[model samples]
Target: MPRLWDETVDAHRRAVRAATVEATAELVHEHGLRAVTMSQIAKRAGIGRATLYKYFSDMNSILVAWHEQQVTVHLEQLVSIKDGPGEAGARLCEVVTRYAEITRSSRSPHAFDFPDLHGHEHAVAAQRRLRELLGELIAEAAQSGAVRDDVAPAELAEYCRHALAAAFELPSDDAVHRLVAVVLAGLSASDARS
Candidate 1:
């Protein structure tokens, strides 16, 4: 009887996980992360609060899972661009642009949105990985002379990231591209004509 009970519990847990993913994806798509709530997810999933809690400790866990999934997709995209033939700046621009597009398209939740991961180990690790990748790419672009050397590669990468992420708030893609050019210019050597 105990073994049978354990099996049933495992099945229930699996069901809740599937429901959580579905509900989270839907809520984020429809209402954005800020508007999503634990209670709403539970109701949408047609599961009791207790059942939801049994599978996920809270909304933060679910959001983190979603972010992990998104990151997996983004990583694949980055890998393809990293290997693609092109100027370093163009490739880097492609990467940043795609990343910005992905973020803009989704109402997906960010790591900070989850209270449970506010200072979580996994969150810190993920951020570190992101910074390392950004820094490497920026440094590469600088070495290729496509980006200026005055500013640190990591700083350039971060600036590009921020600009792209906030692109939607800007008036146009032209504006965003111009902003990127400005950052690149700042990194380049001074313009001197003979």
Candidate 2:
């Protein structure tokens, strides 16, 4: 194929795949994971059953792909926050707060229905990258006396992750924000010194 034709084909494939994943997520959200069928997913995605199978082996695969895409998007959003203009501490706070909001807002039925899905290697890798990114930010903030120097950056990063995990179950936006504030306060060098 010509370069332009190849590009067009690639774009089409991505669109189809994205549509299929999104449809699967919607179905799972509405009907629960075990209740959703591949036929329903194909219908909701506006694709033929054969076409859906060409892109994914089964509903579980579709859900995994959808979850991977969500994780990628969340990581990209954090990367954007990390690169955006701000002091290191402020950027870290923004990233954590945004992360908390994403966690709270993006809960799906499949999360409870298929807890094993989280053990996927890609998900684990994404989580590791999130920790590393936060650790780097903490190290930078520590140099500027914004975060505590007493703890290793890696350990502090773990603390932040554990603290923010509560956002997934928090009752309201106010509660999530309060959790973030508490996490940040614990990280603050000023609080440590005083």
Best by lDDT: 2
**lDDT against the true structure, each candidate:** 0.69, 0.89
Clashes of each: 3, 0
Leading candidate by TM-score: 2
Candidate 2's error at 97, in angstroms?
A: 1.0
Models, CA RMSD each: 5.8, 2.1
Candidate 1 runs further than 4 Å off: 1-19, 31-51, 102-123, 150-152, 158-168, 188-194
Summarize candidate 1's per-residue lDDT along 157-189 as a digit string, tens digits: 677656566655555557666655655555454
Task: Score residue 4 of candidate 1 by CA lDDT.
Answer: 100
